[model samples]
Target: MVEGKGEAYLLIDVGHVLTHAAYIARVEGTARLAAVAEVTTTTAAEGGLLDGVRRATANLELLVGRQILDRAGEVRQPRDGDGHGVDGVVVTASLAPLLRVALVGLTCDFSLASAVRAATLPYVSLERTVSLEGPGDAWDAEDLEALVQEPPEVLVIVGGADGGPVAPIREMGETLSTAYSLLAASQRPAVVFAGNERACRPLEATFAGVVEVSAVANVRPSPEKENLGGLQGELAHLFYKRLGRSEGLRQLGTWAGSALRHDLDALARTLRFVACRHGLARGVLGVDAGGNGCRVLWVRPRGPALNWAAPFGLGSGLGALRQRRDPTAVVRWMCHPISWAEAWDRLSNIEVRPGGVPETEEDWDLQQAALREALGATWQGAVRAWAGYAEGQAVGEADMIVARGTSFTHARTPGQAALMLLDALQPTGLVRLALDWANLLPGLSGLAERDAQAAVQVYDNDALLELGTLVAPRGVLRPGSRALRVRLTVAGEERAELDVPAGSIRRLPLGVNERGRLELYPARGLDVGLGRRGRGGVVEVRGGALGIIIDARGRPLGLPKDEEARRAALEAWQREIEQA
Candidate 1:
C-alpha cells in the first residue's frame, strides 16, 4: 500500500468463540477489502491457537484463490512473484485467559481508583484490592494470608505524591515482602511500583529475588493531578508478558512480529485514531459486547480515554451477569412474555453452550435483553469514572457511535441492532451509528503498527458499516404531545414532513449514502443539540441501512413500569422501525 510494498495483506483475530481472517490489498493507492472468513476458535484443540488461524486462512485461500498456507500448513511470510501468498500478517487475540492482578494502595479514593482505571482492560481481572487508609500502618494478617493463598499474576502498589512522605509506601513494601516470602519463586507475583519516586529503589530492592519488579511514573503525582499513561503502559507490557507464556501465542507472535496486540488494546487505539482522524469535536464511543466480556470506550480529542470492562456478556460471562444484577432486570427489556424461571433456564443453557444460537423468538428476545443490560452496566461504570456527568444521566453526545461484537453484528435486522444500542446507551443530540460487521478493527489497528497510511486508508474506506444518523432530542413532555417537527429535503427536493411525538421513535427513509437537509423545530421544552430549547435550524444529514432515526423518548428513556404496558410500547416501537 505504501510506494513499493507488496499488495496483499492478511489480518487475523482469535477471539474466545471465533477466529476471523480478513484479506485486504492495496489497489491504486487505496486499501480494498478482498475477502473475509471466520471459523470456530481452536485454542483448546491439539494444534492450539494456530489451528484456528490456519483454518481461517485456509478459508480465505479458497475465496481469494491463493496459497496463503504452505505444505507445512504455516502462513507464507511474503507473496510469491505470482501473488500466491500474502505480503504481511497481523494478529490480534482475546482468547487468552484474563490476567489476574492485585492492587495495594494507601487510600481508596485516590491511589486505588487510579490503579483500577489503569487495570481496566478487558483481558485483566482484579482479584483483590487492599486499601491501607485506616489508623494502623501494619498490614492486616488476613490480607497477607489471602495473598499467599491466592497469589495474583501481578501486584500493583500505587500511592503518594512526587515529594510526599514515603514512610507509608515503604511499610507497604515491607508487608508485601513478608507475603512473597511464603510463596515459591514461581508463584510470587510480579511487582509494579507506581507511587512515590523515592520508594521505587527500595521497593525494587525489597522484591529483588522474590519477583519481577518494574517502576513507572506516579499515578497521582500530586493531589491535584493524576497521570495514568505511565501506569497503563506498564500494565499493558505486563499483560503481553503474561500472554507470551502461551506456546501458541508465542508462535503466533513470532509470525506477527511487532504487529501483535491484545483485542481491547487494539480497539481502544482504533477508536482514538478515528476520533483524531475525523477531528470529531464530540469524539467517538465504542461498545464491544463480546462473548467473554463487555467493553465500553469513550475517546475524546484532548483528555484521557475512559474505558470500562466487565466479565458479563452473552455467553461464557453470563454467569457473572446473573450474579451482578437481579434476573428481573434483564426481563424488563424483553417485549415477549416469558416467566422468570423459564428465562433463567434458557440463560443457563446459553452458559452451557456458549456458541449456540437462539432458535426461537423468545430465546432471541432473552439474549437481546441480556445484551442491553450488560451494555448498560458497563456504560454506567465508564460514565461514573468519566467525571463529565452528574448522577442518573444518559451518555454524553458523540459524533459517532460504533458497535462491535456478535450481539450487534448478528442481529436479525439492522433496525433491531440499532434499537438495542439506542435503548442501552440513550445517546443525546446528533450522532452517526455504525457497526463493525467484519470484525476488522483489531486487525486494522495491528496493521497500523507497520504501515500507518495503509491502515488509515482501509479504516476510512472499508472498516465500519454506517447505520445512518441519529437525532435524539432531550426533554420531557406528555406521551402524545409534540416533541419535534422535521422537514426533510433530498437532492433539492422536499421528501417528507412529519411531527415526532414524545415517547416515540420515527425513522425517515433516505437510502444509503444519500444526503439530506433537515429543518428541525424542537418543542418549547425540547433541545435537539441546537444550543437551546425551541431553537430551530437546518443541518446536513447522511443515510445508511436504517435511514434517519428521530428518537424523542427523552434523555433518560423511560419504559412503563407495568409489564403489559411496557410490552405494548416495545412492540409498537419495533413495528415502527420494521415497517419503515
Candidate 2:
C-alpha cells in the first residue's frame, strides 16, 4: 500500500469489454505517461475480473520495462528500492450490472424529476417509480405486493418541502415497511429517505431492523430550490457498497483504498475539474458511449453539473437502441444502401457478439450509425434535464467537448470520430473537439484526489487527443450560398482562405499543435455564437488532427427526406472529412 504521496502511479480501467492499464511517473519534474496496455475483459465465470487486470498489468510491465506485479501476481505497491513496483494503484470500473432502483416520491414534477436526475448514472437502472401525488394517496395493495415480489436494490423515497407536510411521507414509509415485512430478509431493498426532515425520525423508526435506511438532505427543499448533490452522493455510496459484493472488485478496492471510483462518476468529476481548471467561459461537455451504456455530462464553471445516462450503446446496448428508436433511424445515417432486414441482422449479430470487430464496410457503417443515434438520444435527454437549470446560455454552448469510450476512440480514423461527434452533438458556435483516446479520464480523476499537480500535468500533456477546432454556425441559409468567409494565418503568415457554403462542410489544412489565427465573416442571417447575426471576429486557434472544420449545415442539422439524397449527403460529408 502507498504510505503517502507517490511519484509513480499505476491506473487501471476495468471496463465491461476491455481492461486498460497505464503507468504514470514524475519525469524531469512533470508527470508523463510511461506505458499503456489493454486486454479483453474476463467474466466472473472465466475466473473473475482480476484475470483481465493482471493480464493488462503484465502487458504494461513489458512496455514500461519494469515489474508491476510480484511473484504472487498481485500488484506490488509502494515502489521498491530497485524500481520493481508502483508507489500507488488506482482503479475505475464499469463492469458490474446496473443497480436496480425504485423511486418513491411525492409529486411527478418536483421530487420525482429531481430523483430521476440524481439516478442518472450509467450503472443505475430505475425499475419502478411510485408517485404519491394524486388524491388517492394511499398505496395500492397490488403495488405493495409487486414491491414484495420483485424488490429493487434501492428504494429512493423523496418528497415534500423541508418544512412542508410530513404525514404523507410517513404514510409512504409505513407502506414500504409493510412491503419489507412480507419479503425475505435478503429480498428487502435498502431505503434512502430524501424527504421532509421532519419525517426522517418517523421513517427511521418505521423501517428499524427491517432494512437499511439512509436519510440524506431533502431533494426539494422548497418550491424554488432543488438540491440533488446530497442524494446523488448517497446513491453513489450505495452503488459502491453493492459493487463491493464482487470478489474481484473487493480485492481491487483494498489495493486502491480510497482511490477507487466508478467510471461514470470519475468521468463526471474529471469534466468538472477540467472546466474549472481552465476557467472556461462556456464550460466543458463530455460524452462516453460505452459498450452497454451512453452518458452525457455537462459541466459549467459555477453551477451544478448535469449528467444524463442511457442504457444503450454500440455493443451490448445495440439491441436496446434498436428497440428505443425506429429501425429506420439507424439506417438513415448509413452512407451505403442497406435493406431493413440486412440492417436488423447486422444489429442482431452485434448483440450476440458485442466485442467482435466489424469485418465488412456495411457493418462498420451500421455501427457508426447506431453510435450516432445512441449519442443523439442521450444528448436530447441531457438537454431536457438542463433546460430547468440552464442560466441564460444554451445547452450546446460548450467551449470544449471530450468524447470517450470505444465509439469515438476506436473509430477507423480521427476524421470519422470528429464527424460522428459533430453529427451526434450538432453543437453550434466555435468549439474545440477532443477524444479521450486512451480512456485516461477516470484514472486522472482518481489521481487528482491524491496528487493534483501530477493529475493536471498528465491530463494536459497526454489524456486527450485534440481533434481541432470546429466552427458551426446557427441559422437558416439558402443552399449553396456562401455562408461564411474564413481566412487562416499560421505563424504570422497567411496560409489559406476559403468561402464556406451552406449545407456543406469544409476542412482547412492546419497540422496538430500549429498555432494559427482565423478570421470569420458570417452571412447576413448566420450567427457563429457571436452576439448578433453577421457578427464575426478573429480568434487565436490551435490545430488538431482534423485541423479547422467549418460545418455550415446549420442548427438542428437536417437530412434529406429521400433515401438516395440522404446517402449522397452522408457520403459527401464523409469524403470531405476523410480527404482532408
Candidate 3:
C-alpha cells in the first residue's frame, strides 16, 4: 500500500509549473519518479488552482489515500508534494507573463551586451535596446533611420557600468531623445536607462513627450563587475505587458499564475539558488532552447549576457523581426514540411498560439517550417527594421542564437525538434548538449511567478518526452571562430575527438539531480561552471537532461591536432578518466 517506501510527493506548482517531478524515495533504493506533470495556473485562483493539481495526479488513489483533500476537497499535500500523507502542501507562490520591457544603452559593449543578455533570458523579452552607435559604432545621420523609424516598446539605456565615462553615455542619451521624439504620439516608446543614473532624469524628461521612461540601477555600476540581474527582472516586467494583454498567452498565464518569468530568467534565478547550494562557477554554461528562443548561461561574479551582449544565444537576431511583417529569412529552423498556404495559416495560428501542435505529421512538418519562416523572418526583420539605420551591419545569423520560435506540442520526440536548433545556432564546441524545452511553456514563463525551479523540474523529467540529456557534442559550433574539433571528453576518458559544424550538437546522457544526474561518463564539464570541486571535482551543474561539454569558445580551449598534442590533452584529463 505504501507503494514501496517514502510517501508519494507531488510538487503543486500553483503557478506555471512545468517540470516539477514527483519522486518517492526511502533511505534505501533510488527514489523512482511516480509522476511528472506540466501545470499552468495562469488566471486561476484558490479552488480552481487546487483542482488543477489534483487532476495532474494520475494516481487518484494516491491523493485520496493520503487525505490530501481538505474540507471542500482541496489539495493540501504540501503544494510541493514533499511526502505523501504529509498534511502540508507544496503550494508554490509563483506568477507568469509579468511585463514587457525596452532597453536603452550608450554602446554595444559589455553594458549593452549585458542588457541584451538579460533580455535573452527566460523571464524577459527585451522589447528593444537603444544605442548611440545606430547599428555600428560609426553610423552617420542616415544610419540613425531605424532608431527613428521604429523605436522600441521599452528601452534599457546602459553605458560604462558606473558613470565614470560620460561622453559615450551622454551621446547615447541625446540619440535616445532624438529617436523617441520621432515616433508618433500613439507609438511612443518606453525607456529603462541603466547607464549613468546621473543622466537618466534628463534623458527621461528630454524624451517624456515621446514615450514613457523608467530607469533601473546601472547594470554596469562599475567596470570591474557587471550587474544585469535587476535589469533581467525589469525586462520581465516589460514583457508582462505583452503577456497580460494577449488573449491566448494571457489565458495560459493564468495557469502559470500572475507575473511569469521567462524560462531563461527562471534558470538565472535558480542558478543563484543552485550556486548558493553548491558554490562558484568552475566552467558552467546552462542552455534552454525553447520554441521562440535559446538562452545560454554561465553564472559568474562578472558581466553576464543579461546585462550586455557577449554575442550570445541562437535566437540572436529574433527581435529584429519586429520591424518586418513577413519574417521568412530566419524561421527556417522549425523544419516542418508545409506549403506556403498552410505555412501562412500556421503562422497566423502561431500569432496567437505559438505552441499549437499540428494534428497530422504533414501539417506538423509544414507548420514547423512555417515557424522557421516566421521567427527567422522576425530575426531578419528585426535586423532589417534596424536596417533603416544599421543596414548591413545588423547581426543576421551572426548573433549568438538568442531567439527561436517553435510549436512543440506536436513533437513525438525530444531530439527530433530541439536538436534542430542545436544544428542551427551551432552551440560553441566549448559548451555542447544544452536543453530544449517543449510543450512546457511554463518553464519559459515561470520566472515572474517564482515557480521556475518546480517548472524546470517538471519539464526536465516530465515533458522531456525524450529521455536523453547530453546528446553527443558534435556538429557545427561557433563563437567568432571557424574551428571544428571541440576538445570534448567524458570524465576525461580518452578525450573524444568531435567535429561539430557552425551549428549542431552531439548527444550524451541526460542529467536530473542526484536522482536526476545521469551518470554515463565521469563528468563532461557540465557541472556548475565546468564541474569545479574541492578535491572531489564534481561541478554541480543542476537540472540539465543533456550531458556536459568541453567548450573552447573565447577560452580558446586546446584541441590536440597532432599525435603528441592529442596525447598531451588526453593526459591532462587522464586523472578524471571516464569509467571503462
Candidate 4:
C-alpha cells in the first residue's frame, strides 16, 4: 500500500500502564501484523518514557526473530536481505499529560457550557471556567495572580453568538490581555478566541505580541447552531505542540517522522473507519479505560464524536476516584457484600500496581465491581457531552459496542467482558459486543491514514474479538413474565424456540466465526429497538466465543434493595454467562 516490497512498518502505542510495539510487514506485497510485545511503562526509568518503548521494541524483535534497531540505539530502516529492519515507524500515546486549560466565556449556562465540553477531551483538562458576566473584581490582581501563578498551557475564550453581545466580548478580551500581561513571557499561555466575530481584530491587537493568539469562528454562531469543529481542531494542534515539548515524546516523534498522534483521536478514527466501511449507519460506540483516564468515542454516519474523563479509573486514578458521588454505587455489582472501606482498599492497590491482575475469586469480584462503576461513570460523562452538543442525542442508538482496557481484555472469558459491558451500559436494544483485547486498534489507527486497506483488513480480521450479540429489551415486568421468544439458527443448527423470562440472563452456545439468523419477539410493553411492544424482527449476527446473550434485565436495569437479593441476582447473571 505504501508503494514498496517487503516493507516493514513498526507501530508503538504508549500508555500510562503499558507500552506496546507491533511489527507489521508487507510480506509478498501484503501487509500483515508480525509480532507484538509489551512492557511496563515507567517514566522514572533512566531513559524516561523511551525506556518502555525500547524494551517493548526489543521484545517485539524477539518475537519476530530479527533485529529492528541498530547498536547505536535507533530504529534501522530499509529491511536487509535477511529481514533485519523496518521501513518506517509510527507512534501513538495515551500517556501524555493533560493540557491544563482556562476557559473564559460569557455565561456558565450557555457559552461556558459549550467551552467546558470542548475542553474535556482526553488530553485537555479544564482548570478554570471563568464567566465574563461577573463583577470587575473577578479579574482583579488576586484573580489574575491565581491564574498566572501556574499558567495553564492554553486559554480558551468563548462568548455570545456571532453578532451578539459586543461589549461583553470586548470586556472579556481586555480582561484576557490584562491577565496575559501578568504572566512571564516564557510561561505565557496560548489564547484562542471563539467569541463574537466583530471583536476578533481588537482582541488580536490587544494580545498580539504579548501572547500567542488564534481566532476561530464563534462557537455559538447564531443561537441555533454551535460550530466547535474549528476550535476542537485548534485545541488538538495546541495539545500536540505542548506535548511535543517533552523530552521523550520529542524524540519519539522525530523517529516516527512526525507521525505521533493522540490515543483518543486514534480510537475515534479507527471506530469511524470501521463503521463507515461496514456501512453501519446506526453507528459504533467504543469505550477505553486506562490507569489515568477513560475515553468514549461514538461514530455516526456524519462523523466521530468523543467524551473523556480523567483521574477516574480503577487504577492510578484512585485519588480522583475518592471524589466520586457515592461509594456504594459499585457494591451492587459484586456477588457478595463488601464494606466501602474494604472495596476502597482493594482498589487502592491498583494505584500502586496498575497492571496487577486478579488471581482469586474474591479479587475477581472486586475488580469487576470497580470496572462496572468506572464504566457507568464514563457512560454518564459521554451522555452529558452529547446533551451539551445536541439534545435527545443518546448512545442507545449504537448497534455495535467496542471496548478496551485491562479489565475487558484480560477477562477470563469473552462472557466476562460482555457481562461487564451489559451490566454497566444497560442498553435496551440488540447490539454486538466486541473487545479490542489484542490492542490492535491503536496500531491500525496509525496505519489507517497511510494504508487504509491494510489497516482495515487487519482490524476486521484480527483486531477485535466478537464477544457476542446481545438482545436487551426495555420495560419492566413481573418476575415470572415471559419477556421474549427467540428462534435462532447457527452453524446449520436450529433452536426450535426459546423463552427468556423477565429479570434473567440466558446464553445460547454459538461457535466463533459462525453465522446465525435470529427472530426476536418481545412481549407486551417490551421493545428491543423496534417501534413498540409485541414487536418482532429478524436479523443476521455473527458468533464468537460467547454466543448470543438474551438479557431481560429491563431498562434502567434494576437491583433489589435487599442486599442478599441483589447479590443473588448478580451471581445468577454471572453464572449464566460464565457457564457458556
Candidate 5:
C-alpha cells in the first residue's frame, strides 16, 4: 500500500499445470512489476485453490520482502497499519474442465457451422451436433437419448438468418422443447438461443420452466454479418459462474471481491491495447499454448476473433496434434531421424507428466519439434475461423505476434525462440516478435480496467521481451537464387548490405534499443508483404537480442525428400539460428 496515488496489484493466473502470480506496485504514478512466481497447480489438494495462490504469493513476498497474506492465510487487504498488504487482488484461471456442449441448428453450412465456431471458444467442447432442416427432418429417438445420457452442460440452438424463414425454426424449437421435457430437472442442460431475433423470445418461452434459457444475439445475423461477440461474452459469463462454484474459486472469489477474469480474454484485450497504443494497422496475433489447450486471439480494427482448441497444445493436448495434423509432421522438422514408435513414447511421457521439461539435448529437439506442430495446428484453426466468421476475409499479416506459455518463455535462447516461431507460424512479410516471459499479460489486462496508464507503463517498460523483427517473403525463388537484397542502417550506426539466398534464414546483429532503416529489394517473383514481384520498399525495423532475422525459406517451407538430404538441410538451418 503506497498511500493512495495508485494501487498495488497481485495478479494470479491458475493454469492447469502451474499457478502463476505477478506483483505490480505503483511507484511514483507508474506501475512497476516487482516480481513473478509460479508453483504446481493443486486443484485437488485439500486446501483448494487458495493453497496454491497462497504458495505463489508467499514466494513473491520473499522476493519483494513484503507480506501479502495474514497469519491466518488470508490475503491482507489495505495498508494493514504497516503498509505490508496489497490494495487489491486480481485472479484468472484456465484450470476448469471444458464444458460438454450439444449444438442444434437448422443448416449445417450457416447456422450450425457458426455454432461450431462458437463452441471452439475456450472452456467449451462440442460433444455432439444435430442438424434439423425443417418439419420433415427426422431425428432418431435413440440419438437424442444418447445426447441426454452424456448430459451436455449447455445446448446451443442457432439457425435462420435475420428476416429469413420462420416456420423451420419454430419447428426446431418445438422439437428441442420436447427433447428437454424428457430429461429430469437435474439432467437438463442450459439452453442458449442464438438464432433469429424473432424466434429468441418464443424459444425462451418454449423452455422457460423446463430449463434455464439464455437468449443472446444471433451468432450469424445474416449471410454477411457475424455478431459473435455478444454470444461469446454471454458464454464466457456463464463459464465464470460455473467456475466460481468450484471450492478453489469460491475461496479466491470471496477474497478477491471480484469474479475471476478469464485468462485468455484478459490477455487478448491487453494485446489489443498494446497494438492500438503503437498505432499498428495490421493488428496483433497471440498464441497461448499450455498443457490443456492452445488459445489464439487475433484483434484487428474490424474486431477480435478468437479460437480455443482444447486438445491441441504442447502438453496434455498433444494427442490432438496427431489427430488434427499429419502424424509425421513433428518428425519432418527434426534433423535426426525418429521412428513413430520413438516419437510416440516421447509424447506419451510428456502427456503423463505435462509439467516436465527437456533435460538432454535429444529431449530439447523433440520438444521444439512437437511445439512447432502444436502451434501450426492452432494457427491453421484460427485462420480458418477468421475466414469463415469475417465474411471470407483473411488475416493478411499481423503487425505483432506474441508467443506465450512455458515452451516459448523458457526456451534456452532468443535464437531458439525466433526459429520456433518462424518454423511454426511461418509468418509472411515483415513482422515483430515478442514473448510473454513473465506471464504478465494477464496482470496488465487486469490493471487496464483500473489504471490504464499504469498498465501501459508496465507493458512497455517491464513486460514484453522483444525477440527482434523478422522479414520473410511470401513467394519462393529458384533454388539458390537471390531471395532478398537488403541494406540495413542502424540509427547513428554503420550501414550494411547483404544478399540472402532462397531457402535460408540470416540474422543481422542489432541490439535492443537500436532502431534501423531497411531498404528491401526482393527478387523477381517474390513478394515481401507489398504487392508486385521484385518491388522494393523502405521500412523502419526494431532490434532485439537476436537482432533482425531475414527468412527466405519458401512459403510452406520446403524440405528435401530424401532422408539424408532432409537431415542435412534441417541441421544447416539450425546452425544458422540456434547455434549462431
Candidate 6:
C-alpha cells in the first residue's frame, strides 16, 4: 500500500480463543491482509504476541496502520513497532509448518460444521476430523494413536462450546501431548487449536515444545453463533503463511485486499444496515441469538447504532429462563393454542440434553418448562437486563425488530420478530419486512466485502426494503389480508420484483451476492423469479414447528428436511450455483 500511496492498518480482536492482528494495506484502489499467521492466544497476558507480530512484519514492512483490542476496544492509532510496550496488550502472528489438519469438533451442527467450512473455505487440504461423542476422556491411547497415525500439518480442534470447551480440553491436551511427544521434533505436526477459547492456554503449556502450536477463536462461538469471518480469514492467513510461503496469495491477496470484518460483527452490522438502508423509515432492529449469547443492533437514520453482543444464548440460558418464570407469558405471538405439555416437549427436544428426549406427556411438560426456563433465562434476559444498550440518537420507537439466533433461528427462518410482533399483536399499524433466513444481512454485507461492485450490484430497492408507512399502536390484533407489489430497478436496467403478500412468504431465485426487491403477487401460487407464473419461481413452503402464516422472502433458502426432496432441492440449487 505504500506504493499505492495508501496505508497499512492492523486490527487486533480478542475473542474466546485467538487474538488476531491482521497486517493490512490500503492504497488507491487496493487492499490486502496476509491470510497466513493467524495465531491463537493461550496465555491471558500473551507474553510473546506483540513481539511475534512485529517480527513477522519485518519480511514486509510497508505496513502503515496498526490496530489492537484493549478488551473494551482500547488502543487507538499507536506508533509502529513502538506499540509493544505502549499497551500491556499486543498480539503477533504465529506460523506453523505445512498444511495437514485434523478437525476436532463437538457436534456436526453449527460450530463444528462452521469450523470445517472455514478450513475447507481457503480450499485448504484437510487431513481428518476428530470427534468425541462424550468427554475427551472417552478417547484413550488408541484414539490418540489414530489422531497421530500420520504427522498432520496442523491439528484444528473444536467441540461443545455452550458449556465452554473445557472438559475435553484437559483430556484432549493429555492425548495430544502424548502424540506430540512421540512424534519426531522436526516433523511434529503444529497444533492450530480453534475451539473453546478456554482450552488454548492449558493445551499450549501442556504440549510446549511437544509440537508446533497456535490457536484461533472458537469456530462456532456458541451453538447458533458463528464467527466464520474470523475463522476462515485466519485459516487462510495461516494456510498462506505455512503452505503458500507467500506464493499462494500473490494476486489473490492483492485482490482480497487488507481490510477485513469480524464475521459475527459484520453480519450484525449488515442486518442493521438492511434494517435502515433497505427500508424507507431508516430504522431497523436486527438481532442474532444463539445458545451462548445474543447480538442485537438497532439502526436508525443518520447515526451510529444501538448494538451489543450479549454473552447469553437461548439454549445455554434455558435453565435460567425457567428460574425467571413463564417464557410464553411475555411472548404472545405463540398463541397457536400450544399446550404446556407441547411447549415443554418442544423445549426439551431443542435443548438436546446430553442424553434425553421427552417420552411422556409429563416429560413433555417438563421439557416445555425447561424450554420456557431456558428461553426466558438466557441472553433474552440479557436484553431486559441491558435494555437499550444498543439504542442510538434520533431513535423514536423501534420501526421493525429483526432477530436471528438458535431460539429464533431454530424456531422460524423469518418468523422471529414477526412472532414477537404477532404476540405483541398491536391492534393498529404494523411494519413488515424480510427478517428470515438465519438473519443474513451479513450475507449481503459479505457481498460488500468480497466485491464492492457486486455489493452495489445487489443493492437495489427490492434487494433492500424501504420501510412502508405504518403507525403501530399497542394492542393485539391480527390483520385479515393485504397485498402489495414492489419493483426494484437497478442501474436503470436489471430489475427484481417481489409479488409479496401481506401474510404469506414467497421464495425468490437468488443469484450469488444478488439482492431483489419484494412485490406482492396479484394471485396465489405465482412465480416471482420467473415472473407471471412461468413455472420457474413461486413461493414454496415447508412448515416447521415454529410458525404457520408462512411469511418470508429470500433466494437459495437453507437446508431441507426430507432426504429425497432435500437432495432434489440441492440438485436444483446447483442451477443457482451455476447461475451465481
Best by TM-score: 2
Error of 2 at 360 (Å): 4.0
The lDDT-based order of candidates, best leading, equals 2, 1, 5, 4, 6, 3
Candidate 3 per-residue C-alpha lDDT over 425-446 given as tens digits, one digit per residue, 9 for 90 to 100: 3333222232233323223233
Give the per-residue lDDT of model 5 (tens digit) for 461-549.
Answer: 88989988889888877778899898888865556788999988888877787899888999987888777777899999998877888
What overall lDDT, based on C-alpha atoms, would model 4 receive against the true structure? 0.77
Residue-wise C-alpha lDDT for candidate 2, range 252-293, written one tens digit per residue: 677544445788778878888888887777889988888887
Worst 10 residues of 3 by lDDT: 307-316
TM-scores for every predicted model: 0.88, 0.89, 0.48, 0.87, 0.87, 0.33
Q: Output the lDDT of residue 151, model 2.
A: 90
Best by lDDT: 2
Residue 247 C-alpha lDDT in model 4: 75
Q: Residue-pair clashes per candidate, as listed?
A: 0, 0, 155, 0, 0, 61
The whole-model lDDT of each prediction reads: 0.82, 0.84, 0.41, 0.77, 0.79, 0.42
lDDT of 6 by residue, 1-580 (tens): 1211223333333222233333433334454433223233333254443333333333223333233333332333332464421111112111222245677665666556677666643124456765665663366455567777776666777765735847667676777787678767876766667777877777788787687567777777776777656566666666655433433223212222332333444544555565556563546655544444444555555443444443333444344343445544322212233555465455545444422334664443333333333333333443553343334422323556554433333332232333333322221222433343322244345445434443343343113322122212221112223333444333344344544433333333333333333223333332332333322322322122221122321112223354455445433432222221
The CA root-mean-square deviation of candidate 2, after full C-alpha superposition on the true structure, stands at 3.3
Off by over 4 Å in 3: 1-32, 37-120, 126-130, 133-149, 159-187, 200-216, 220-233, 236-260, 268-580
On the 0 to 100 scale, the lDDT of residue 60 in model 6 is 26
Better of 2 and 5 by TM-score: 2
After superposition, the stretches of candidate 4 with alpha carbons farther than 4 Å from their true spots are 1-6, 27-29, 100-152, 158-168, 179-188, 195-198, 208-210, 217-230, 256-258, 323-329, 390-392, 490-493
For residues 1-580, could you state the per-residue lDDT of candidate 4 as single tens digits? Answer: 2333336778888888888888887666667777878788868655687778888888988899889888876787767789898766768888777678888777777777776766656567667766756675255466566677867888888887877757767666776777678767878888899877887877787786788679987877766777777788889988888777887778777864646777777777777777887677777888887877666777765633555554677777765766775867667788967888887777778778888878888889988887888778878776765654543555435878999988888888887888889887887687878998768786787776666666766776678888888888989988769999998886567854689999988877776787788889899879987777778998887777778888898988889889899898888888888764
Worst 10 residues of 4 by lDDT: 388-397
Residues 1-580, candidate 1: write the lDDT tens digits. Answer: 2223557889998888778999988778677888999887875555788888888999999998888888988777677888787778888887666678999999888877777777766557777988887877557778878887999988999998888887788777887887788778888888889898988887777776677678999988888888888888887888888778877787877764434678777887888888888787777888889787788777667555556677888888888888875857788899988887787788888876776778989888999998998888877777765554322324445799999988898899998999999999988888899999999987888777777777888887788888899999977888989999999999999998999999888988888779999999999998898888889899999898888999888977898989899999989888877655
lDDT of 2 at 522: 98
